[model samples]
Target: MAPEAEPRQPPVDPRLWRYAAASRSFFLVIALLSLAQTAAIVGFAFFTTRAIVDAIAGDDLTGTLAALTGVVVARALLSLVRERVAARASARVESQLRGAVLDGIARLGPGWTATRSTSHLALVAGRGLDALEPYVGRYLPQLVQTVIATPLLIAAMWQADAISGLTVLLTLPLIPIFMILIGLATRSVQRRQWETLSRLATRFSETVQGLSTLTVFGRQRRAADAIERVTDDYRRETMTVLRVSFLSGFALEFLASISVAIVAVAVGFRLIDGSLTLSVGLFVLLLAPEAFLPIRQVGVQFHASSEGVAATRDVFAVLDAAAAASAPPAQAAAPAQGADHRLRLEGVRVRDLPPVDLEARSGEIVLVEGPSGAGKSSLLQALLGFASATGRIEFDGADAASRPPSTWLAWAGQRPGLASGTIAANISLGDDDMPAETIQQALALVGLADVDPYRMLGVQGAGLSGGQAQRVAVARALARHLRGHAPVLALDEPSAALDAAAEQHLWQSLRTVADAGALILLVSHRESARTIADRVVRLNSAEVTA
Candidate 1:
């Protein structure tokens, strides 16, 4: 079957402007700076021509030279200001865009990001958004410069030489006309480039992550060849984009050059015929290129920012969906008077998991044990709201859906996430405000006291033993429980990666948490795990046993 087509995307999303903060002050600064720049450009031309004419007329040029020097200095300073402001605005825009993309991903949850490949998302957030630098820093400022300075420069030219001004006015429209025509083709190429890059990144990421399995199967060469094919395709798309950019730039340059030559020739003839002064002819000649400079730059910058424009569509699509699906504000629930904690699952079935009807209480551990392939993982996911199911989960007799997933439970997954950071930071997941003692206390409760509070662990616990990583996961859960925030604790195969001794130690830690008035829902088949349970629930097909 043929693959489905991707939906069409706009050239750029206007909503991105919302994140940029490049609105009122940004535009005002551009306008003011461009006005100053226009004046400097015109004055530089006037003074430069005046100095040259003074020298040719055999007149003393000390004053003309001084005037020219001052104008040059002013023009340079004004140019500097324009460029600096543009760079700052671009930086602010890129920073804001990146933050928005990451925040949206977090809020959207893995359910959303899992559908998009990790490498594609990473590229979008990192290198993809960097393309906006040229868009904002160079293209946008040039656009504004054209709007503000172009007319003023043309008017200055008309005051000096009417025929040359007429020539500029007639040809000015041609640059944009061709730009629009080629820009249509350029956008199409950019879209293909973005798609190819995404495919290439996805292939590379998948190949790298599965290299071990591929090697075991002796198919690593096949995977390598596939990645190389995608990379070569990406290379070709990139070259196509560059070719368009170069061609458009060359065309704009050639057109502007022709226009300037016409004006220069007319001025030179008139200068010899005594119909125009040399100073005025020189001034008109200088202003001619400035009139076309903005449009010329617009052509060049479009390609530089094209990737970012394409990436924005993806970013906004994710953010828009996340916004639409934005979880409603959780209503605060008052706990039942006399209940320590209560978790009730009424006819809950997730994926292929058998339907479950269960009730759990705090201050005790409830172990769900069965042979593998009983959908224990799916059942846990349903309870955590990570998977879809048909029944109601209640906490303290309130609908579980009424509360955000983060509100009621502290979780320790089958494989927990660990960052490369200090032990305390890892426990808090980089929330620096979480106290050091809080982390140490949690680690102590999970039988990880010997693990230094200040010690740094690599991502996925590269610095720590498998047992230690498992303990860190437990410590993370315990920290939340100790904070008196979450009432129920859900741990899925927490010791699956540990040895017998480590597994027993892990169960002892969980038993302590359960004894301390937090409800524990553990999935395990180990005899040691069952010994710590206040109640062991077994699943056989669709039946539940105690």
Candidate 2:
């Protein structure tokens, strides 16, 4: 499935100029190479035509052939240079744009992105952005040629023979007129295709995530029906795009064919009357094809790049929203702090959940317990600033909103997203400076003494038992706890998958954390987990809901 299209804009959106400018040095080289290629095309035509006339007249051919060969070699070298520069520029621009989109997602926080399905975002970032390669590598260079080479050829043709030049000049505008009409006809369909693909991807991802639940509920057949409907829609839309593409190609080719034929016919008559020499006539004849080359290529490249153009629109929208969210309202500032290390929440409300009031100091395990759908997790989410609530959360001596998540929270989820790798790497994901000794200590704390630090684990801890997987998750939290000062350990069902023995060991690990003066927030329903908490706060399932 594909991602949804952003609002319609130009094929090359204005927001993309920043990325283009970042690769300006490479683009500059490409431009220079294009200029040289244009010159070689002109020189190539002149020499080849001169060689033909010399052959017809029984004159010397060495100089004309030699010049033609030199021009061919020069054109080949310039083409190679152009390709290399475009490739580099393509890579650089793609990297910058992908980085921007990912960074915006990071800044906006998980809560916002969670509104879209996992598969949709992944597709947009991966394959959708990849479609831009042709846009940069092939289309952009042809656009530059159309801007530079086309005019030069027309001027040269006119200088050598006025009638031939007049015919070409009169017909040139028709090519773009056809291109514009094609674009107009296909724009809405292309946008709809992009959007439908995104919806299909999003729905598939959602179904996969809930497949077990669907199977249990005996609704898998219905899910299958929904998917089939989406696929059929996508197929229909794809056919429409192909139909338009064929029509566009046929129209451009027909126009170019007629225009070139007119030039050839006019030049032939001039040569017959002795008003134009054969060399000059052949020269103008050759130049006719070159004049239409760039415009035709531009139309093809434009069609190839439609998918990327749609994705860029969505990427830019995300970037714009992230920039807006970076600064909160003036009234949202937190009140000054009073305690050394304390977390206080007052009248905090998220969605339909009842207002919550809570307070805790450092050096304690504060357990948050409740029935399903009681908004226990929502409380933690609110503290993480992922949910909008009408309340104040003060950490240390300042407002929690004033600081980023890294400064105050160490979170481990119910389903730990442990990447496929060695145990040590999972423990210290992306934080290379974290010492091996620290990771080992974290593992030992969670009672995994025998697990080798470098042992291979399948994707998301596939090879590990349920208990060991949970322990790895706890170790991740502990590793984070060890690194940050004045941090809170926030765990959601950390012992849900563990056996009695493993659960006890995990509880003991939490006790050790609480005893060491770290503030901890544990969300669990098990008696073993509740037993280890310094203070247990259990709300009735009916008390609140989000």
Candidate 3:
């Protein structure tokens, strides 16, 4: 049967309404503050012009000065309030977005994330989200105020004089129309540039990670040259985006300026003909630019928002990938306890590979003996639910494939995966509550007691020998053993890096673990590993028998 589809996520483009809805109260407050500020500024200009005209007309100076002073004070206070509210709202949105993205990644799990590049993911979480800052703080508030205040301001202007208001209204739409056309033209280019940037980041991360290998092969110069070429491509793409952005800005500015100029000319003619008063003409002149201000600002902000939009697309692409189908819910019944919880692999076949049959009884050792490429490693991975395998894997009469295998199995691979932290932290792997004494005991059991528990291991277990690294991996497995239930242990080439005595002790440790009723399954190329196994299963191209 074909695999079932994974759950679908929302569309790639982030919905602005969703962001507004998430922090509605903050947005509402910001909207009110922005309108208040716009009104105060617009009101200040109107009052100032009125006051100057009154002074020229030999009217009361004291009243005019007091009115202008109040306008200035109110404008300042409203501007400050707008700034404060916007900062808080932007911070809240950024926090929520970061957490949501991380949670989404977590739900997708290692199986999905393993295929993606760390650098690309980093860019999405870091730079991509950073782009949203202005959208939340500045553009969004401006958009809200423009929607609310622009109409009111225009209506007031109409009350002052119908012709001037009409002039402003007709010119307003032209700015946005020009901006939209320019945006549509550049949208595809912006998307391509973001892809190129992500590719560059991924390649740079890979090159840095493999710097040691390149140096060893005497190909560092070639790697540097390759990086330079990619960077040059990235630079060219960035310049294209910059050029388009500048052109868009210039276009919007020119349109707004022309629109304001038209309103100015028409108002000037009215004033000259005595059809409009000085106060009304000044008000219309000030409000004319204000009408086109939001549209022009939006044009500029959209360019900034494009980076985030592109990044969000990449983020959604990862979240939208179909994950491997999980086992059927009906097959997830709990396995029987004690001796019945053993693993049985019956005719387990992997694709383009051989079939192998094996079983491990409780408190027993099942040695998987084979040379390199004998499918021993692949078999272990299949058992751990990392690879798809055909046939049945029964756990105490329950199908192993039906439930999570990690609940009962502990796997130790050849390469010991360690982060840059203390030895105890590495073994516990973020289990902060794990006792230090328990960590020491596990290390001692794996013959790695010499290494300090609090000592820092460099990135990727650097400075450790092959055998020491293997021992650390073994120690990690033992630390897991310290937890309540003794899970089934499966090690691939556990003795490959140990000395004769250490290898003997490691086998003894496995035997000890097995004696405690835990199924111990190990893969080994050494003949000596057979001495510790209760039953040895040999696998070849198409044969598996005891």
Highest TM-score among the candidates is held by which one?
Answer: 1
lDDT of model number 3: 0.75
What residue pairs are clashing in model 2? 1-201, 2-197, 2-198, 337-397
Give per-candidate clash totals: 0, 4, 0
The residue-by-residue lDDT of candidate 1 on 1-546, one tens digit each, is 997865654433557666556644667798899899889898888888888888888999888888888888988988888889989988887888788788878866664565678898898888788877887788777777878988898899988878999999998988989988888888888989999989988888898899999999999999989988988988999999999998998898999999888888888999999999887888898899988887787778777788876777777776676665545445555333234878898888766677888888888898888877776777787776677788888877677765556666778887867888777777786344777788888888767788787887776777987777877887887787666656788888888778887777777777876776789889886778878999888876667676
Which whole-number lDDT from 0 to 100 does residue 483 have in model 3?
A: 61
Model 2 per-residue lDDT tens digits across residues 49-87: 998988989999998898899999999988887887788
For 1-546, candidate 3 gives per-residue lDDT tens digits of 996643332222344444334567776797778678777767876887888788889998798788889989998888778877888887787777666667656644454466678788888878777877776777676667777777877787788889878887887888768876787756667777877888888888989999999999999999899889888888888888889999999988998898889889989998999988898888888777777777677778777767765665655454443222233356444333344456887888866567877777787888887767778888888877666678898876777755565456777898888778777788887456888888998888888778888887889887678888888887887777666333578889988888999999888888887787778888898888988899998877767777
Candidate 3, clashing residue pairs? none
User: Residue 351 of model 2: what lDDT?
Assistant: 80
Task: Give the winner by TM-score: 1 or 2.
Answer: 1
* Poorly placed runs, candidate 3 (over 4 Å): 1-33, 66-70, 73-174, 198-239, 257-281, 316-366, 378-409, 415-423, 435-472, 481-488, 495-520, 526-537, 541-546
Report lDDT (Cα) of residue 30, candidate 1: 89
The CA lDDT of each predicted structure is: 0.80, 0.80, 0.75
The true-versus-predicted C-alpha distance at residue 208 of model 3, in Å, is 8.5
When summed lDDT is taken over every stretch of 10 residues in candidate 3, the lowest stretch is 6-15
Give per-residue lDDT, candidate 2, residue 492.
88
Per-model TM values vs. the true structure: 0.71, 0.70, 0.67
